[model samples]
Target: MGVTRLVSRRRQDPGTKWARIAMAVLATVGVIDTGSITLKRWGFLGELTCPMGADGCDKVLNSSWGTLINGIPLSLVGLIAYISILLMTLMPLLPGLQENKADLSRRTWWGLFTLSTSMAAFSAVLLGLAVLKIQAFCFFCVLSASLSILLLVLSIVGGGWEDSGILAFRGVLLATVVLLGSLIWISAVDSGRSANVGEKVGVPPAVTNESSIAALALAEHLAVGGAVMYSAYWCPHCHEQKELFGKQASQQLIVVECATDGQNNQADLCRSKRLEGFPSWEINGEIDSGVKPLSILADLSGYQGSREF
Candidate 1:
């Protein structure tokens, strides 16, 4: 066979083995992220409330980031990617056709390459937006980011690295498309429409009686209540927390980044703080986890902000 013909081989390279392990980890992350969001959205997980003691899960989920492109939950997207990674990584375990071994390897390589490259680039952008643009954290979002980062590493070290040149080039082209699309769409859209930079809109604060931007800024410093929020940038609920605080207010409270990639990284504080879940809160140091209603949260925290809890 000509060297250029790409030889018949198995994807079970030593590196592929490691990549498999990494994909397993990302898969687990997806499961955790999706599971949490499901519970929160369904009201099965409502242990924590906001400073106003309001429930804002639905509010945030209904927002933009919760879904991708047209209408796909970010969790579903991660689930698909991780599942794809799992399948591609485990391709070796599949029974090979009597005469299509080389074709199989090439196909698997191309698939894995495509999946990993797109996911990695997307994660990078989401993470950047989470901190610099949105200035908020979502445990699930960060979890996905970490998983994507791992997948990217696995793709590179895995045997697919050799086969990924074409995919990588394509990935760059696609990334350019995405970036340009975002720039164009954003430019065409309302500049005041909020650029994923978490900010306040809609209703004004009923509690503090002051929704002024300055008041919102002061609220952050006053304390975010005894709440432990487990969040990832990719998580809509976490963004809900930011929305509640009005972008500027969300920056004041202490946050934990459970996502291993340090997506928002309130300084590796989650582990040190023994944070157990995303969007979890410790009201007066008492643990009340998950997306919660502002009213209920206020009651729990003894909200004295002039808002009924």
Candidate 2:
């Protein structure tokens, strides 16, 4: 009789159905946001159009803190998190789960609370990095952080928890854990911080990758064609462009530092060119932005060199 009464009460309890729907919608948006970034990073998609400008988006996404130790994009992690939240949000609403709806709802609410709390905490850490460390703003990152925080708020106010004290305790503990973990992870992956010791403040890390013979020949060809590369010292995509040419080949190309504080800066020249983004290339008096592949550069510059790169 006691078990029957408990089950009956559980079934009659008014769960926040509206909150779940709202969360699902937000999670779906998050999935699309992060998924697109992941695809772009992996070369599955072309250049992404940033809301305000592409410079901040390029710098932040191509920075040292952008990828995991295994070279996986950090956006993929957020994508998985959003997908999990979306699935959990919809699980209890399945028609087949009606018999266990109350029980499932209770369990999934706890899961949502825990997951969203962690996501919110980690997003805070990323936001701090973007503002303080990277000194670049990414609209997508801000959107994800906002979504995480909103989901957290919804999880709290929408859960309709019977025990507020327990929820508070768990939330605190989860947040603390996520905070420490995020700090440690950030410290580990921040190669620029570690490599920049005693160096100029805005200088990018040196490229150590060796260039192939073909790459060197292409670099020479681009130089003869009057192709010039304009870059900012603090831009990771600029560094990436250098890495592609390798140390030896990079020296053969005519490079202009665009950052005002960068060594050998040609700020006046860069401004005259009206450059919109870093790692811009000027071939045949035509300017193009973003990191281009060696083959693309060769074609753009009308290089007849070996295309091995």
| Lowest-sum lDDT 10-residue window in model 1 | 201-210
Candidate 2 residues lying further than 4 Å off, grouped into runs, are: 1-15, 191-193, 196-198, 209-214, 235-237, 256-280, 285-309
Error of 1 at 4 (Å): 5.9
- The per-prediction CA RMSD against the true structure, in angstroms, equals 10.4, 4.1
TM-scores, all candidates, are 0.51, 0.82
Name the weakest run of 10 consecutive residues (lDDT summed) in model 2: 3-12
The TM-score of predicted model 2 comes to 0.82
Per-structure clash totals for the candidates: 30, 0
lDDT of model 2, residue 274: 80
